[model samples]
Target chain A: MLGAFFTGSAIVERQRLGLAARATLLLLCSGLSLVDSLHQANGSLDVLGRLSVLVAIAILAVVAGAAWPQSVWVPVAEAASVAVLVMANAGPHQPLLPYLLAPALEAGLIAGVRGAVATAGAAAAMFLAASPFEIRKGQSLTYSSTASEWVLLALATGLLAAWARRLGVRTAGSNEAYPAAYRLMTQLRTVSRHLSGGLDALSLAHIVLQQLRDRTGFDRAAVFVPGPEGELVVLAGEGNVPDWDTSLASDGLMAEVWSQQRGAARQSGFSGTKGLVSMALPLTIGARTVGVVALERRFKWEMEDDIDSLTSILDEAALRIETALLFSEIRTIATAEERRRLAREIHDGIAQELAFLGYVLDDLAARSEQEDMQGELRDLRAQVTRVVGDLRLSIFELRSEVQGQTGLGAALSDYVRSIGAASAMTVHLVLDETPNRLPVEAEAELLRIAQESVTNARKHSGAQNLWVTCRINPPAARLTIEDDGTGLGTGRDDSYGIQIMRERADRLGATLSISTRPEGGTKVDVALQARPVEIASDQGAGRDQ
Target chain B: MTTVILVDDHELIRQGLRRAFERDADFEVVGEAGTATEALRLIGELQPGVAIVDIRLPDANGLDLVKRLRAGSEKMGIVVLTMYSGDEHLFGALEAGASAFVSKDAPAEDIVAAARHAAVSPRAFTASDLAEAMKRRLEPTGPRLSPREREVLAMLAQGLGVAAIAKQLFISESTTKTHISKIYEKLGATNRAQALMSALRLGLIRQDPSPDRP
Candidate 1:
């Protein structure tokens, strides 16, 4: 009974519960033990010894529980206290015998079924040991029955506690599931919204051109933005515009409007092309010329009202265009920064560690006197060397990018050459690129797709030869990677690599196809079509002015 | 003995390379620096016979450092040791006047040999894949400018305006402009000046009065 009181008080103290509950349970157990002891007391000294022992055990348990309630040692201390209590109250009809269930229950709650069994076993042993003394003192003749009953009760209570603990654990796991699912749903919604927005500069420029064409009935129109060298290069164009200079000089009509921040018209009736009128308007936002819009009409007509409406449309669209441009620039910089950081991390952390391991292996190889050991170490070192080479390749891939100065052709050539040097496969590269390059982001995506395809070929295809061909014309590009290797294997159709390549192609409105070649290996092809406006303009340019 | 200084951002790489050099009696480990600034300071103070430079540095590009070192002393052997084994980096190191280009994955013996070669001839560029790279460069794979495009590019270089070039070539202004755009496209240049510069670099046009003189 005292053991139960101590256990209840210890649990209550550990939980820092209401004092009333702790006092009521303590007093109830104490009163029951007192009434039972007083009923069967042979002498006052015996009653005093039992009551004092109960108080001592209770004090020890409370103090231990208060000090280390959550410690692993708490259950151990509780078991010890229960054993001590059993020894102190060594009688056939011990009033505190039921109290041994307390430690068993506590152990079960903390350490599960194994702890419950162990603690109950210890309590049973203490009961058995005390029963011998009780029989010798001739206090009772039915000690064995009482002992069995006590052991059964302690075990039953401990098992019950263990079952409750498992139930609590299951509830906790379910509690976290709802929040996790909610977070994923929210994130998916955000990503879907971003996909549908399509706020990139190229798409926005197309929208601006489409709106301009709709608002103004010009035969042909083109948007020109200042290039890296301050020359006006076409950003987007619509209608049959005769190929104006790929880039206009600073003194051209478009440049003049950009410099003056006003619209200007020019009539070019001289030279074979007659009855053609061109007007240029500066796309300004807050006194800053972001770009110039050049409109060409077949017949010389009154363009004054057309110019005013066009100016209003551009004035409204300028900020959006500028924002899109800035957004793309920032995105490119962030991507480059991220790539550099990843390269640095891989180089400094894993690559360095692997190299160091190689050196350590070298030292081990030198120290080994046995030929076989040295040979094994040599093989390990070779493996490490290969891994380091692969890491270096990864870092190089992460670092390589297509920039304005090096266009796609140069970058691709450099990359293909690197691949050839790194692998045993014979690489054949054919690059045909025009001076006009795609947008930086598009070029970057194409480069990555090519890299992925090549890397996949190098790793998986057991090919002896690889061929890469790239044809780039402004707004239109086709990249083909072919290898005389084992054809596309099963179960790789939806691989992450292919999925990522598809995603990249999808973002650029390009088509990606992976197929096994007729003769031998696999072929991965990606082709981006020119915008519809470009095609229309081409057809328009075919007609005489 | 060829005294060598190591410059790599990773200390462990430097240590490994240092140990590799230590095994070779022909080379001495004079100094080591983890950044470009420290490398310059160390090289200046030590004036090592050979400087093994890694292409990636914390403060500056390794190729730029090679250029600066070469400018400081043409006789000092400079070996570019890099993880990037691309032709671009190799050519960059070569153009920056490095005596030898060695990949980090190269064997210690190869690196030692490269250092020895650098010590012997600092002016002669050497790399394992130099011949292949040179062959690739020699291949007629670049965009071929047409005869008309070439003429138009030359006129562009001579500062002839579009109208003047058109009148002189007996072509319409739009036709001349179309030829100029095609030339720019073939040359991967954004403007006439850039086209002219690319033309000059590619030997399509000359610095003299007429491109036909070539």
Candidate 2:
């Protein structure tokens, strides 16, 4: 359509040039004699006069199209526009013309709302200036109707242009914002990694603070607010603290800033903060205010934008920190639990033996007065001796495998020799195969299970002999402890032995079984296999029969 | 009279040991030394048939003196007398060439017999002797862990769990665990029961009350 219009423009301009090339044609074109005669004959250049001019131009352009189709459309638009201009000049209002609305509509299509409004305003000014001739001549023109029609045309054009421009702006703006959103999402993922990797609360807070500080170039940001019992301390900051406190305008309002979990702009327009605009963003982990980031700017800049960026960065970081803190707290709890367990073992095994030895020593001291009871005294000495041997084993267990750093077989062997020397019940440790230290969880659970089994024998089993056998092959470890003692209680009640054996086996992701030997004894067996290397051991172990 | 030599690093211990051997009518102290080198020189010159040694000597560790004495001549019956935890020194002394391992913590009569036994037997360690030998063999390693550390580790070994251990020991859970951890290190234990078992072997603790089951 534009091409067609351009072709017409070219053709009409050429014709005008051709006419100007001839003096007679140019004079006829520019001559004022016909226009003056028409004005004199009719004081108004009204409807008939404008229509006649258009018809004449139409005929002339058609007749000259022998020139070119490529240059015709612009002349057609220009001729229609010029005739309308002439008619408007001649008349105040052509109340009966539907086609008169087309020019304003075309103006709306051509240059949008601003241009159309300008054109309508210029046309209106021209009409009012020219209206004096009609008024003086007492033409009794429909001034209201004509004004209303022009106003309506201007309004319509303005509305159309406004709507189209808005749509275009929004579409372009959206395209630009999406990539940034994508970049922020990637940053979010990286932030998650950093937070989880921190492994504890302090590290998590530091990470969050760094990200917020770097992402938004706030002059100063600090997490001033403390959370629940003052346990939660904020660490991330963007700018210098002096600037923040003063706020470039000295309200001296950290409390005010913190209260408003949203961002605050305190420019240094006050006595305290004249150069700073401090922004406080609440670091919210869930609904709780774990921390608050206060950002202050000493310089006049785009402070709000930076605060917005800071808020987004803190959103994910808060969750991450909260999670990391929780994990660390849990680990602490677990360690405490583990220590208590070890203490119990020591109490059960060696402390009791030493106490017994004390009793034996007391008996021996008292018996020195009599030689008649020498045989009985000798038996007590043997018992004391056995107890001493058991105590040695207990000490070895007390030392344990120092973080599972030593090999299992060596540790077990050390265990047997030490404990066996002390106890009446001899511990014979035989290993069929040896493997590298089982990875942390596997080895730990394995060790725990063995400990439980041995303790059970020492206490309830009353076993005269204990054989701890381990086979490490096929990427698995099988532990079996056979005690020549009473069978698994003949009949059952709640005994801690089975529970412990099951718990240990489950912790290592292993299978476990307990059976009474046909030879009138009991055996506890455990088998551990490999599991996923990444995730840590299952926290809540299940007992599988 | 049977001549005797005494070697103990501690002054009081040496004095006590000297007093102990002197009490015996048949035994007479010919010489005394606080260290292995001095003890060796005295033995070389004096040639006392019975030599009393503290498991721990100033110049050397373990039972090298007993080994040194026996290797030099089979006539010397060397006895290791020391205050050792459980089997740490008991086994170590035997391995290093001591004829016997006797606790200084026990009645001095035991040490005397260890000396006399070394003098008469002059043979390999038997089952009854093996337990004492093993104790002395391991004695030099270290004393039985402290009673508290042992008690904690023993309860842990019973599979009482940390909460139960704490309750049983009347300690805070973490303290109980700390004791357990120390026991684990001393006993070379990985878990509670191992700690307990090791503790039992070390004489750091005693057995638990038996279940009321018949």
Candidate 3:
């Protein structure tokens, strides 16, 4: 019973018991058996004599099988030797019958149920075959009952080992699945991070254009959405079409595609254009067409397959594009709402109170009778008026924005003009803008950077003249604010305005450089490069054709 | 003396303005209203020569109220007084037919002058910065062109053919054509004459000195 407990624990405690530990366990069991036999024989060599040799051989065979645990033949050989030892002492007490179960358990652990059953069957057969011989040798008449008990013990140990093997297999399988699950979780985390970063609509539109070009191999393509007056205005485009119309008329092919909600292809001569085949496809979300993709290729070919594939890609991306568009609209609205709220708060609270204070000063100035006292009151009233003027400018700045129908150039012109009017410095503005505008988000950022630079110059730089120049081409722009003021002084490298300008530039992927010009002024220049969207090769190929 | 009715949501502002007007014998504050509705009623009953209105009212936009008062009586002087001094607000008040637009930050003397101007000529619009703003707006602001494109535009405006312009600029004919097309695209025109017209109109390129041009 003790040996059984030790062997069972060794199998359960360790997933794969080491060969040395198994040898130790088996030798310990053999020693206990030898001691038992010696005690039963009164220190005589009678029963212990045969049992000692068989126990020694049994331990050797079990250790050998443990050494070669992966080999099926080893377990079978171990089982045969143990079965022979069991039959040698099988008559009445059946001391070695329990030892036969060891090989069966080892075989079960090594090869699962099949090996266990085979070893158990061989042991049972040897026991039955040797039982009649033991009975003939006048051993005992109760040998049949002992033989049945030995076979039942062997079968039970085999099933237990088989059960342990199934548990081990399940654990191994789970161990293999852990990395796969971890990888999937990491991907989900990355995707969620991007989603939370606020996907803007322009980037989505660019992506749509990119995917369209990659799939259809169009020479030129443009994305058009309905303008305020219901005309199709280009939101984004790629490649070189010299006659690329920024806005399409209501009766144009692109507009027809948008209104009819179907894609159509036309030969070049149909539109009275040369060497270009045009295709217009509606970008629809559900039943509503949100925009149109206008494509032009150099040569005419069968477009059925191209149209089908383009439609599928657009269909797959429509929901994400719409969501991004809606999100941007909401963000714009929220920003405007917050700005309006701030403007209202300032106007209603501090502005009103300050105005009231100015009025009070006016009344005080008028009420004072003494000339000297009245003069002091008038100076105080002038100071109040100055503060009120500053407050009014602040309120105007809060309310100013690059809203609909007001491009960045107009907004900046208005702001700079106001600053000039309010300040003592002379402000010069030169606006050179392309008809094509930047993405709304980029324009907004550029406007903010311009505003910060101008405000910094106005507040800090004791300059007499401020020159603001804005030059814009589609996908590229440059804004320079140069002031004939004191250059950036010492210990002002990390000013808050510069930090905000840098951050805004970083967000727009633009470059901002602030330096003191040799002509005795500080100059701030911000430049934005065209996006790297794989258009040069396509344009080159088209022109070559 | 010119009678004045104050239409402001803040009582302190009205009180101060009343005191300022009391010092001057030419103006008399007949009534004050804190809301647009009350202001309209008071203006109807009092018939003051000038109605000083704040752009932001609790009940209605001060510009809309100015429009209503203008519609009712064409000769009634309406002076818009508010904290907002943006060009949009100035223009909004101007389009709404306010006679004078003054920011709240202006001294009481300026407000009195604007009211006097409104009373004298109610049809004329006046603001302190109106002339400066108009000058800034009238300055040429249009689509930017490259130096090369400007040269090409000048040549095109001078009635030079594409080949002649190409030879003069020392660039390939194809390059010159590309530049011309880019100029056309930028100007939103189709032909050389249209492009030149757009350029001349936008001050991109000046009209040449021709004897018969004038």
**Which is the leading candidate under DockQ?**
3
lDDT of 2 by residue, A1-545 (tens): 22344445544553453333222322433344345455565643444465455445444544544344333233334324432443355454333222223333333433456545654555455555555564435454566455557556655754574466456445545564577568755765565466432244445555665565445444344454343222222233322231123121123444454455565556652113344444566667545665565544444534357666667788887666655555544554575467657655554445444534544444454447776576666666666655554553444454565242455655565566655654567777767532123433344456667876786677677889998987753236789989998868843442665776676565445789888888877788887643222111111111110
What would the C-alpha RMSD of candidate 1 be, to one decimal place? Answer: 23.9
Residue B206 Cα positional deviation in candidate 3, in Å, after optimal superposition: 6.3
Candidate 1 docks with a DockQ of: 0.17
Cα lDDT tens digits for candidate 3, A289-376: 8888877776664547677667768875666666565655666778778988998998888887888787777778777888998888
Q: Each model's TM-score, in the order given?
A: 0.59, 0.35, 0.58
Q: Judged by DockQ cut-offs, is candidate 2 incorrect, acceptable, medium or high? A: incorrect
TM-score of chain A of each: 0.56, 0.33, 0.54
lDDT of each: 0.73, 0.54, 0.73
Give the RMSD in angstroms, all C-alphas superposed, for model 3: 16.8
**Quality of model 3 by C-alpha lDDT:** 0.73
Q: Candidate 1 has which clashing residue pairs, if any?
A: A1-A96, A4-A99, A435-B185, A435-B188
If both were scored by DockQ, which would come out higher, candidate 1 or candidate 3?
3
Model 2 regions lying over 4 Å from their true place: A1-383, A399-406, A417-430, A434-437, A487-519, A531-545, B3-23, B29-49, B57-60, B64-76, B81-97, B101-110, B117-214
**Native-vs-model 2 lDDT?**
0.54
- Please, what are the lDDT tens digits per residue for candidate 2 over residues B1-214? 7788888755555565666677777788898898888988888999997887766565786377677777888767777764434454555765666677665435556666777777777544322356455454564455344445544554554566877765665544444544555456667879756766666666565576435312
